[model samples]
Target: MHKTKKNKKYTGKIYRYTMLVFVISFLILNSFVHWQMQLQKQTKEAKATYTAETMVQRIETYLNQYQTKSVLLKQIVESDENMNMVKFETLADFIIKGNRALRGIELAKDGIVSEVYPVESNAQAIGLDILTYPARKDYAALAKKSGEYVMAGPLELIQGGTGMLLINPVYTVGAASEKSFWGFTILVLDWDTVIEELNLDGLDDSFYHYRIWNMDIRTGKQNLLIEYGDDGLKDELLVSCDMRNDTWYVEIEPVNGWFSTTEFLVNSMICILLSLFFAVLFLQYAIHRQEEFAHHEEMMRAAKEIQEANEVKSRFLFNMSHDLRTPINAVIGFTELLERHSDDEKKVTDYVKKIQLSSNILLSIINHVLEMSRIENGKESLNEDTESVKELIRTIDAVFETTSRQKNITCEYHVDVIHEYAVFDMTKVEEIFLNIMSNAVKYTPEGGHITADVTEVCEKDHKALYRITIQDTGIGMSEEFIPHLFEPFARERTSTESKVLGTGLGMPIVKALVELMGGTVNVESKVGCGTKISVELFFEIADGKRAEESDQKQEISSTEGIENLAGRRILLAEDNPLNAEITVTLLEESGLSVDHAEDGKMCIEMLHQKEAGYYAAILMDIQMPQMDGYQAARAIRKADDAYASIPIIAMTANAFEEDRKLALESGMNDYIAKPIRMEIVLDVLKQWI
Candidate 1:
């Protein structure tokens, strides 16, 4: 009996200990559940806050870009005292086409809305006076008073659209101490489109629903500009941005609301389960932590990549600056020297030669940049014509022979051709050869050998295949550098290369042009040895009839034929006085009678003043005051006057193929891109007149 009693007491003690253990474990589980719930709540709120901040920053950046564009447009308009509507329209079209968020642009002159681009969509808004509109007048008045750009809108438009407007008041500096007010340049911004442009579509529904409201209005009233989601949710995080004179508020709420019955039940269930499955919960938490760590590592790597890319871009820009400035500085400095040493013919000639070389270098850099743009836009096209293979080879040799000889480099050129004539684009051929030979001359050391070997590979279907190999015995390049040699701005940082000046665009342009011409370019180089570049190009052989005709033709031996244009009268219409004077002097020097007009309007008037055939040809500037060259040409073509069929040559600085096409489409007989060479002008005159 005593032994049984002792055993019972021990069993009671064991039961009590087990109960105590259960109580302690249950309390620990409850504590964990509470902590988890608190942590989840904090994390959700934190996430919502961070998302809102990021969205705001993105929106701000997008808005600032538009704002900056608006400011630039304002400057463009205010730059000229007599701001032409056509120019403004063109500028506005370019801007609107490039940016989807911008609906259109409106220009007001003397408080009257005069012009609106994309007239089909915003035609009804044209001629609407901003000073007379009740809703827009206050903002216009404010912009005028401040004489600055002012953000206005989210207001109802009279044209039946709701959007925002950025109004910038323009003022002209007068001869007196006072400034004259010149109406406003307004940018119409589509609000919904802006939200789309900001890419804030799904963010509203994913993390939190938000409402943007403006509280500071002219009428001392609060108004909701835009809203998304749960109206009854009172617990929300509020963020505000100062929009000019208004306080723009964004109120966001968690999708599930702060106090949710589902959340409470989930926490309770989790607390109960934690008592039994604490190990599993710990494992899941550990996995989540590991995922977070990996995400952090990925983010760090991405940041590093971004930094490296930025560094590369910065270096590229720096190199571009150095390259561009070198030629520009040389040109300017040599021109000054020429002006000072005008009396010394030899010194003047040397300075002029240096200036010409510098100018050529500058033009090459510009061409490379423009060519890249054309390639990117898929606008690069080939202009094929019948070319004499011998002449082409001779021209290439002529181009590099002098430079190569000056540098003491033994440059040799060899051409093997089955036919003397082939159909190819001469301009593209010259560009490719010039770039390659220029590089060969620049990179090859003094006394080094450079050989250009050309051979006909094959001929079938009237298409001829040719291979061109340019080998230079100079400090070549490392294997790794060779791979990136054709990349723009790529250069190997070697001691020998440091003294060489280049845009680093030659190989890239050459490769691009070769590929465009349906050819392949390959390079083989080893450091301390040499570099050899090979290109294979295909061309169509000129037909027998054309080849026979070309063979029968002989070169003009004298300028007596071209002298027929010397006594002819020419009409030159240019806006800039300096350019016009220079053109007039050139025409006079060529023994041609020149008539000057300030603009296209004057040109038309001047032509009307003369009889048919009085003026041999009319040189028209495309961008002029009253009427552009295109419109003027069209007007002249439609006229019933004698000069209706008179040859019109477009003279403009626009050097694109599209510009040439447009000029021809506008009834111009010929197109001359400016920085006009006198010889080219004379040639055009000889052809058309």
Candidate 2:
């Protein structure tokens, strides 16, 4: 009877403990569920905020770079006094040059399409009447007629891309208002480069649905141009950027963000788990409630630790990356300075080569970190449009040409398949080509053959498919590792003797770029044999013509074939002593007489001393002491029968929009950015003098 009473007491205690445990578990679980929900909500808002911030930053960066490039170009165009080239020809050259200069803007100079840069694959734009295209001809016409800068709609530039166009008029000296002489200088850029790069850097891959639109707000509804993944996405992120005359909208819908049918099951499982544990405790024996509570507490603590560690690591890496670029920038900039001053041809070449190599290395590191970040986060994809295959191949060849020569390798190039220009990003393609071609040149020994070829595949109606093959008789790869060729950070194990070294992001980037361009890359290799990398792409353009003929031809020789610089009056206004000396040496080599000035005041003094026409052209450096070039030039313009009407060309390194404006406003005609190339200087002199 006493034992029975003891058992009853124990059972009652167990029941009381069980009830207490249920109440504690209920509150804790409820808190956890609420926190998880809040966490998810916060994650979504954070992602959107981050994406928007990053997009805006990149847009601003690209625009600033492009603006700098454009101002430099306009400065050059107006100052070229000796340029006998017609306005049409000038416009042609400027377009091609401008496109090369600007990195990420969708470009269109509506008023004129020059033949120099010509219409390579302008099938989408060449015809179909710009008159009918509201954005192109109409706004461009107004800008040209009005002699002012005009911005157009965020229109679809080609079949694969969205961009904005900027048009500005070119007027004569005495022209009133914006409506003046010469055709318009149109600048167009596809925004996808930075946009997609940002997307690659941000989004996770398994994301079920995403939609991106280059929004046009004409009819109250947003126009979706580039949509990805799905139309079924519920929660979304919308970001706006300044697009031409208006703004661009980018919307992101992550699949993981939305509650799926699978999610309902997950929530059901949670409910079942809670109900089963508590319900069973009531029906069955209630025991060890305290231990179970302690275990749940332990698990939560562990998860918190792991999350904190990961966050710390991410912050560290981001800070390290931020710190890295500063030193790299200094190195690159200083090396450029050294290269310009080095008068020894061989030394100059070697220094330039090293600079290029260093730049490429830095670029590779940046790309690697960026790719890793993107891959880890699951959002790396390509949004490629048509690019010049010829330009890409030529750049690759040029990059390795000197290296190949040093190794005594015969670098043969052939284009059989690339009949028409297709869509792709030049920067990404350049990176891929650099990686591959650099490897080829690095690994191949003397007398080895390295051939680059582009050929055709089976074609469909009116569109011809093409394949680009780069085959190198360098140290070959093993057959065992062909599958992992496209994988990140995997260098071929078999090519052990190959001196070529890389961050292993090369092939992966190439693969990504190819996929982005809507293509495939296949590698075939044998031990002790050679490696063949075949990249296949789709290409078609109406009236398509291959660029192989011209691009593959002899490159523009760097040396200016001038007889003499002696007796040729020259003006030099420069602040940097090293550059000035180098310029003097280069000019002396061409036998040119040179005059020097420290600032605009001195230049004006030099001009005043001479009677009518003293110097061929005043090389007025932009930034200087005691009446800067701009102010001095203005004074020269306002000279009362004293200062000569000399052809004053700006010769400074201040390459920016405002700089160009101030330079032009000060009465100087031409402007040149620093880190001066001798060829550009010579050409400038020849054109003016």
Candidate 3:
């Protein structure tokens, strides 16, 4: 009887332990399955959003290209009011030949279509009064009223099929320079051809269904254009693309819905199996618990470290964002002031100067950010060139002379070097010194003294070790802050509190560049007293003959006369209309006649069509739609024609040492970084032309 009682007790214990293990395992497995389902749904939704956005961008770009062409046609018509049908046909043929999506081009005279390209099949569109058409008249009127381009339809076309119409209103200039409406320049885009060109149908796959539609503005109802899958779409993921006068929506959803029933069933079965397996192996789990505990502790430490790093980055970003906005806000505010006080000459002048100052500050912040990014990504490299130590010091002095004088600060520089010229990365060395000096000047109170001392420490193996020390009687940092002084976005005081403007990336950049050049940097500061920074760098002594040759070349280059630039004609190849307009204005203001090309391809064609000596130079932008500046430069050089030797200067926003080198390598005569100052442009132009 006692033996029977013990057996019963043992069986009850086993049953209880098994049930506990099964319950725990089932709960965990079910939670994991739920988590997996949520993750899958999130991933699908993200992908759908991405796909929708991509389609929108592609369609917008396609539409914008036709809009640009339409504007170009309008410009041609307005320039020559007597443009005959033969001339119109020739221009239309050129515009429509390469693009398969274009159905045809039409010229409407006073809202009546009088001309159509490819007159055979599209003749039916000729003489059709577009303004009288019920479906098209509203958009036509809108185009005329707004004095801008307007888009209409996926409506039935007289030439057959469905298409969209881009209407650009043309205006004629009378003898008194009065403008009158001259009807429209219309571009017909075939809907099916657009879909085929953009591969819209291919976006749908086994995993997802998509629908594209436009809203009818008149009726406030969705006009479904294309769908790939089921009859009813839930509009789970929707993205709107804005065209000229309409917004098109792309909606996407998972084919199997957000949660898959089949997947859920499979996961549930696996969870059940896993629960049973865990119950069977419950006794063995205790054996490995100690090992798992140790692993968990290690994982926790790693996660803590990762979190700390993330927090640091977050803090840095927060500080940078605040610092970046100060100058930007100043620029924006001053611009508004300038606009409001346009008639006041003195206020306008003052506001313009303030705007320029703010712009410079904004540029400095951007430069610091870019420099830090390059350093962090390990993309920065030394471009070693022979540089004069005296010249470097002179340049720095010249830069700060005005600011120091304005603030009543006495800034002095002392240099004692055995070698005057050394082979070093001039840009990097200049940046390091400039960054330190700028901070010293910024923080130093008015009437305070600042000094920069440069001396040769030692020489070995034909390399000279130079030491630079900058000292300032300024608001020094706290002892505790010194440790984090070289960290990115580290600042001693907030700009608002200190009344100082800076990105806080300067010192970090200085430290990074110093380290990159196999150098050391040290700082000494006391809160009430002052701050002094010392940097030691080694540079190879440049060959005397080479240094002399470089100096002579620089002298000769600087002496080149820019007077010849007056009345000179040059080609400005740029894609953006605003940039092109700004550049043309600047060039024209400098007494130079400018001919603008929309892209590299157009620039090349214009060159080919012009006389050999017509254009004195070509200012080519590096990034353009068809054939970039590099390819254009190379082509021009390889043509071996009379114009092949024409000077091509790269005027682009790609402002980096490597970019300049690449431009030169691609047969460009010179490179001009944009935000183009007229003086720099003229200097560069004078050298080549």
Q: Cα lDDT of all candidates, in order?
A: 0.76, 0.60, 0.82
User: 1-689 in candidate 2: lDDT tens per residue?
Assistant: 98667657777877776667666666777677667666666766667656655555565566555555455545455554234436545554554563542322122233344322344444345333332455466665666556556655456765346665555565534334342355444456565653564454454434535454543433456656445564565777666666444466666666666444554465556655785588567636443433334467885776578679989986656434432332254345546446445677776676565566445545544544455456445575544555566656655564555567546789888766534465455555566565566666666667798888867777777566767777788777778888887776677652354554444555776776676667788888776677888777665543333344334323442334254344687878776788778877776676677888877788888777887765777788877888788888888899886444667778776655467788877887777666566666766677666
Clashes of each: 0, 32, 0
As for TM-score, the candidate ahead, 1 or 2, is 1
Considering summed lDDT, which 10 consecutive residues are worst modelled in model 2? 101-110
Residue 339 shift from truth in candidate 1, angstroms: 14
The better-scoring model by lDDT among 2 and 3 is 3
Runs off by more than 4 Å, candidate 3:
1-368, 495-501, 558-570, 574-605, 611-618, 622-650, 656-672, 675-689
Top-scoring candidate (TM-score): 1
Q: State residue 129's C-alpha deviation in candidate 2, in Å.
A: 99
Tens digit of lDDT per residue, candidate 1, span 603-639?
9999998777889899999999988889899999999
The Cα RMSD in angstroms, rounded to one decimal, for candidate 1 relative to the true structure is 35.0
Tens digits of lDDT, candidate 3, 580-676: 9999998887788999999889999999998789999999999999799999999999997899999999999998878999999999999988787
Per-candidate TM-scores read 0.44, 0.33, 0.40
Flag the better candidate by lDDT, 1 or 2. Answer: 1
Q: Residue 212 deviation, candidate 1, in Å?
A: 99
